[model samples]
Target: MDQFEVMSELYSDRSNWVDVRRYPSTVTCRRMLRLADFAAADPARWGSCRMAFEVPELSYRELAVARGVSHTTIMRHLAKAEVGDAGDFTARELDGECPEWLRAVSIRFEAGCTSRTYRYAVALCTFAAAQPERWRVLRLAYECPELSQEELAEVAGVSQPTVCRYLQPVRLEVDESFNDLEVIY
Candidate 1:
């Protein structure tokens, strides 16, 4: 049997066990039924495009180039095929207290880093952040300005390169200027 026929039978059988109120409204159900029918009508277009919509990393522009269609057409098909909760699912995945390493990677992403580069940087950062003793050593480095970066790395039990990566974002100032600007004002 065709996909629409199978879908109808499946829904009919399900409605017998499920509450009518719980089932989607007839109008909404028909819309989805129409979408399925439309997709089944052109399996080549639908099947080839489904992966682009399903895969989070694939962009519509990339799919458009592959499918030889305008991005708008690809987007329209994706919108029709997408479940209402798809966006919510993605949001829920990212909506939580992110670890420091993830926050650092997110910063890099915002700075327009490539995905591969961001992934590698995140892995490195995660490795460094996982070392509890490194944080202690970083604290000591902050407290003791006389200590060299190499010396701090030795105390931290991490490589000098790792220590440099960890401390790169830190800004330290000695405030050597002693002029009283209030008098000039």
Candidate 2:
């Protein structure tokens, strides 16, 4: 189908739009609606922004099925939405802009850290900052504890490794005793 026809069908159902409970309040919903509307005003961005922001629970494949488009098209739209005005930033630029914790990890990784796990941690932070939508998906996964990391990765359009890395810090934080354990023989 043509872009116009696809977008028309997608937006025809108001119930298929964003879930307000996922938002902080009605005000946020209104703000998001305005943004979505603005995004939809441009025919080129309509489908992508809609899929990225409105029905976030659906995977790219699912979105493609719903929209009668290819999965690659869904991915392209979501990617564009994620980039938005921020665009892509280099690791150095991300390090400069990110929080101190992220910066520290990036610095250590850049210094040729021997630990592979540490490098993954750095990659996690860098990826999150670089793709805010993916970060949002990761945060949503925390809320939906029933979903496995694999499921979350599918929803987020990221790799399983990326989902695990995104969640590693939280897992570490909850197991403080692991850090204090000592063995004596």
Error of 1 at 7 (Å): 15
In terms of TM-score, the best-performing candidate is: 1
Model 2 TM-score, all chains together: 0.24
Cα lDDT, all candidates: 0.43, 0.43
Give the per-residue lDDT of model 2 (tens digit) for 7-99: 222222123113544323332223333333334344334545444434556787887888777888776655533212233333544568643
Put down candidate 1 lDDT per residue, 1-185, tens digits, no spaces. Answer: 22222222222222221366656444434334333434444544454434452243668888777777888877765543332222222222256653323422311111121222222222322333344354455566767989898998887788888887877664332122222122211
* Model 2: number of backbone collisions: 0
Off by over 4 Å in 1: 1-17, 60-185
Alpha-carbon RMSD to native, per candidate: 23.9, 19.8
RMSD of 2: 19.8
What is the clash count for each candidate, in the order shown? 0, 0
Worst 10 residues of 2 by lDDT: 106-115
Residue pairs whose backbone atoms clash in candidate 2: none
